[model samples]
Target chain A: MRLCKKTLIWDTSIKWLLVKKMFFILLFTCFIFDAPVAGKDIHVGKDHTIQTIRQGLMKAADYDRLIIHHGVYHEDSLIIDKPIEIIGKQGAIIDAQNHEVDIITIVADSVTVKGLQFRNVGTTFLSEPAAIKISKCKYVTIQNNYIQDCFFGIYVGNSRHCRVINNHAEAAFKEQVSAGNAIHAWKNKHIQIHGNRVHGYRDGIYLEFVNHSSITNNNSYDNLRYGLHFMFSNHDIYQNNTFRNNGAGVAVMFSKKIKMINNHFVHNWGGSSYGLLLKEIVGGEISQNHFEQNTIGIVAEGATRIIISDNRFTSNGTALDMKGNSIDNQVVRNNFLVNTFEVVTNTRYNQNQYMNNYWSGYSGYDLNHDGFGDVPYRPVGLFAKITNSIPAAMIMLHSPLVNLMEMGEKVFPGLTPEGLTDEAPKMKPYAYD
Target chain B: MLKISAVILQNLLRNKAIFGYLVLLCFTGWGMFLYESQPEKAVLSILQIVLLVLPLITLIFTTTYYYHSQEFLFLLLAQPIKRSDIFAGLYIGLAIAFLAVFFIGIGLPVLLFASGMQSLFLLLSGLLLNLVFIAIALLVGVGVHDKSRGIGVTLITWAFFAFIYNGLVIFMMYQLSDYPIENLILVLSFLNPVDIARIMVIMKSEASALLGLSGAVFQDFFGTAKGGVVSILALILWSIIPFWITHKMFRKRDL
Candidate 1:
């Protein structure tokens, strides 16, 4: 009986030894072989082992990086199907040489393209041929790229969680009718586009069907259409972007829950131009914006629940021109300085409320020392009304008789709508950042 | 002609009203700059003052000065000077005094505080307006010998340029609201000196945007070099034609 029990214990010990040996062997194999699986680098240059970028890319496995050297490569559209990093070493140049499609197309997720230059992209009226295009990808980052003479600089389609940073693009096209946007996105979600400078495109940054995006610290100027345009895009925030010398300025249409903060719209002077055009917007906040020397500032049409506060408008055509459905929009705490017309409305009475605004044209003083004007300021002047009715009448604005007529109208309060007045007009301008 | 102009200018400079006008203008310029605290804001206010008050002051002052200088002109007319030289001397003296006022009052402040294309254009516009209105005063002064009638016509002209003309243009726009009368309005704007000055200055300023769509039309009319030349030609015509007509009337006058 004792002998049989000892044999059973020995068998248990041997089973334990076998399990420990297998674990050590597995650990050794992983430590030796798994190092190359997660990390690998292939060089693309004349003297390198990989002669071409395509060869380097083919040799690289998933999660491997392909380093491109400093040389101008005459390549067409190259597709990346693996999760890898394409880092251009020492600012490598990729000339498309009039390619058929995009210069660089990335199809895989978790891919990053950085420190590269793309030039001479193909122009097509049908498909969007961009310098760099990402489609149906996730967790992608495109940064530090310089693109010139391209139809579209950086384009993303059906992508999510993408970051576009520090890219400069200029189209230099005279015919802007056929030019695409500099940074065009469609069907993208959770994208962050920041620190970009774009010029001479149809639109600077255009988004359609994009949501949950943030655009910040970008300078978009001299575009054919809007500096920043959105259609059916929702829950987006754009801040600290300068839109200057654009054709139509920044326009947001059919969007909701948008926050536009601390932007500068400067010198977009055209007959049909506006500093910021809001149409069909719902639940948006436009605050701390600076509109300087623009044709018109804050033209709202068919918008609802928009809060326009703490904005500085200097030398605009009209500070705020509204028509169509006013729908509970609020204009408060803005400085309207040296504008030709303060407020022009399509209708005599609007649903909007104007409160605590400072007008350079205001004649009434703060008599009671309450920091508010003693008399309510009527922003809609006779000239504004006449101009609204007949924009052609603006050419007659220089006649001294118009001043007398305006003065008479102001005293008697007949022609200009009386209800379009700021009740609590501020005596001082708000210090907007 | 030069000696006569110098004498006329010196006599005009001794006049207290011109001194007071200069003081008021300089004070206003300095006060606007002080209150506004920025050159751009100061420039805008100066623009309004130059547009409205400067032309009116120039009109009334020129007409009155011409009437007041009637005896001096008769004395000069008795001398060996040509009729054209006398007329030219009187106009040039008065214009120089007004130009001095403009330079000290508006022009100096603008050059000191706001040095830009816009401010320079506004100053130029103000000076142009001074010349144009003086020419108009000269025409009315020469054509109508009766002091009351001449002053009346001058007042009427000022009223028309300052206020009534714009009113009539607005009425036309209202009547033709259905049509695209922007071009017609542009043509009519060039007819008035004030309108021309306003358009020229406003279009040159970055606030050219303040004209809005009308600005675009104005730009097409006055933005290009060719457009600029056309408007300049028109302005020259406005300035010279009135003076030419007055010169002819002065040369053939019974005075």
Candidate 2:
């Protein structure tokens, strides 16, 4: 009887082991062939409505992809409150049709929106027009979309580490009833704004209360007020952007550690125009940029520790307008060619360095041919020095008598500020592309 | 004729719509003042907006008012007055009434808000620009027989004044870029009323740094006492040339 019971137990155990092996094989095949339900796509537009898509999205689990298809979807505000990827196909246009405050507000993490056109953004007298509003979302990628006639295009407020790349934003101006900015990034950190073209707006890229942002390779032109206007934003880097014929080129006010490189500012001419207006800017490296035919090349008011080197200031009204409080700034190794004035300043007690810049009007000889002037080139004009203390002295700019007076001041060197000299000014113009 | 002039002036002064237009101007002035942190900057911005908007209001108001008072103009024409005298009287009456509204709405505030002699200069410049626009509008209204088409022409002229005229000048400069034509550029600037207004207002600011190239050229030619005289003469020329052309056109037209 014991031998029979043991045999039955052994048989049952063998059967159980075989059943477990079959279950393992089935699980492996399922893992190989089938993805999670979250990976399924929900179509939008045509026969499928956005509301149905949203319902599908709500039912979807994590890592789900919602594919919004082509055609203009006249939907109200779409609130995506889940962690899902809302991908749009080509020719997918989301027209809020001026019904909602925000066209699409994303509250989920890692949302990717591409190949969509947003238009007719609603604007209040106070609130900004936003086509796509993203807040508190992480790792969002917005790329390759055309946004037109919107107040604020793809506004990201209080978001971090988001990539806003390859978008176009056009906006309206001076319409008392409407309010919108093309691309507004407020209080965002570690954001990348790259390769965008923005025009006909109040401001092209407006940064307020932002830090550690990177704006690179954008073309902003014909903006009503400013091309790239920022206030109180710090530690930002902008490189390889072209701001042409804007109201004012770019206004960097009350910001610090902003590194601007390889930018071009050209033909920003008006009564209130400037190529680059730096008011209270601090601790930046403005290098390798080309400023051509602007009213002013660089308008500095109370700026400090700015390293301006390897830049070209050609055919500008004035190359640099240095103010009284602009201290500890280094204007080094720059090319100032055919500007009306190289440097204009008042009350030059600031510890600024006007060294090693090539002045087209430099007359000093370099016998050694080391590309450095044998005698230090003093770019501070006699008229400018005199006008610092006497505001009315500017009237003598083109007078023949004033030329004689300037020659006299040059000989005496009493009216000019002491130690304000370009000690290593280049003998010829610096070669730049 | 005196009664007609008095009626036009009263209608302009007492109208709520005209007062409402003043409110828009006031808001623009206030908005300019609010955005600019410095008082001087604020004054400059307000002056620019005023220069830009005042002309539009003047042109539109004159064109619309002239159309509305077409019966009155016809009745006066049918009476025992010469056509030229009737036209001159109407023009003088419209100019006077518009100037009164302009002085109250734009001129007084510019004077009150701006500092020193700049205020007075801006006030005069604004008035002159306003007159140029009104004269241009009157010329258009008199020339075109169709009222809607006339209004369209006035609006188009305003748009040209506000936006496209500058574009044309810039395009011309671009075309003439390779030439050493600074003197000719100065001549070209005088052709546009907006450019005149811009130069006059900007020459007042501490932006010689920004205006360096243009200012140097302007100062060389127009910056001296001689330059100042030339600028004044240019302003007077801008005011007169448009009126002269308009008057010539008005005289030749049958209406």
Tens digits of lDDT, candidate 2, B18-73: 88877777676655555543355456556656555777778888888878888887
The two-chain DockQ for each candidate, comma-separated, is 0.36, 0.04
Top candidate, metric TM-score:
1
Segments of candidate 2 deviating more than 4 angstroms: A1-34, A47-61, A175-179, A385-404, B1-255
Give candidate 2's error at residue B110 in angstroms. Answer: 45
What does fnat come to for each candidate? 0.60, 0.09
i-RMS, every candidate? 2.8, 14.2
What value does the lDDT take at residue A213 in candidate 2?
91
Single-chain TM-score of chain A, each candidate: 0.90, 0.85
Residue A371 in candidate 2 has what lDDT?
86
lDDT of 1 by residue, A31-118 (tens): 8998766678778986687767778878989989888998888886789998899898875888888775898899999999988889
Off by over 4 Å in 1: A1-37, B206-217
Q: Which RMSD does model 2 reach against the true structure?
A: 22.2
